[model samples]
Target: MTHPIDSTEFASLLCSRLCHDLLSPVGALNNGLELMADETDPDMRQRCLDLLADSARTSANKLKFFRLAFGSAGGFGDAVPTHEARVAIEGMFAQTGRVKVGWMVGDDMLNKLAVKVLLNLSLIAGDALVRGGQLDVGAEKRPGVTEIVVRAEGPKLVLDPELRAALAGALPPEGLASRTAAAWMVRSLVTGRGGEIVLSAPGEPMLLFGASIPG
Candidate 1:
């Protein structure tokens, strides 16, 4: 049976997920600052500066992606520029330097709901590429529906069972956790809008996620 998650609990899970992701880069920024304050060697100081810059960029990129994926971004408009979503996805994977993103979205703009679904699924699929890989994101609008697809191909891909269950909306409510929050959110968003999410078979060489939402 499918379990339902209340809004309050779901919000808390999302917040936990955001904090967990930000912790590493934000901690690096702090460490870099501390090192800069104590380091007297010119070269060491330059290295610290570089680390600080990289960390700051990573933090900013994560925030931008999270803002769109989990927060109230893109203003009050019902539609958001597809370019923003593409940029957000690119920024999200750029920090790892392991994954390459191919954006095949032809639509100039998509409804805000579609953008959210697109980014969230892309995030999940990209993360599954544990050993780094190619992530291709595509989206298109039909007469009465929006379709989004994310494909991940890598040397080593690992999609956790809990996440898979969450995406399929089969996880029990008590089984939900921060790690599976994004997957749950994707399922919720698509299904709530009278849509469906599809996952590639477990033994597939590559991971594919597709969502179709009716307007």
Candidate 2:
């Protein structure tokens, strides 16, 4: 069987990916600038150095994870490792921010489309609970097909309007930049799969039929 939206354009996708990685460094620079202004003593500068180093490392690790998640971890033709996807999610949270990512879903090798789809959805769920909430992720495969299902769980979900809008592709997510990027990433991956998005809300527990995987 042929897939409808089975491929991603690397050049355009690369832009999406670069958008995600640049944030950490830009944010770190802002923090570093603040540090530079606040302290005059050498010891204080050293402290700043440590902070900078930590932030840089955090950014680097996050970049690696995002590259695997949003960028091209493997070639377009290759199946992405499900374990790698899970690890990338964990790594994103553990290194980039403070979210504690918990996996409820078992692992299996997923195609590139599935990896990117799950990755973006996980980010959306994590964003919904920005105040450090637990992330529950799960997955299932279509009956004897290459299709797959993925999900994210959390309490007190914070669904950004722009993110949602971008998910629908109703408007470009220029305002809620990061959230927008996430929205675009997920929507693009899911849409690129020629699938539909089934979204629940902040008040809802389960986001059903979020997307239909292609065969």
Best by lDDT: 1
lDDT of 2 by residue, 1-215 (tens): 11122134434544655666677676886798798898999999998888888777767667777777667787766787788878778876755555666665555677777777777777666666655656666666767434334344445556777767767766532333443655665666667667766666545664432656665
Model 2 error, position 32 (Å): 5.0
lDDT of 2 at 94: 50
Give one clash count per candidate, in the order shown: 0, 1
> Clashing residue pairs, candidate 2?
128-158
- What TM-score would every model get versus the actual structure? 0.97, 0.69
**What lDDT does model 2 reach?**
0.64
Give me the displacement of residue 103 in model 2, in angstroms.
1.7
Model 1 weakest lDDT span, ten residues long: 1-10
Top TM-score hit: 1
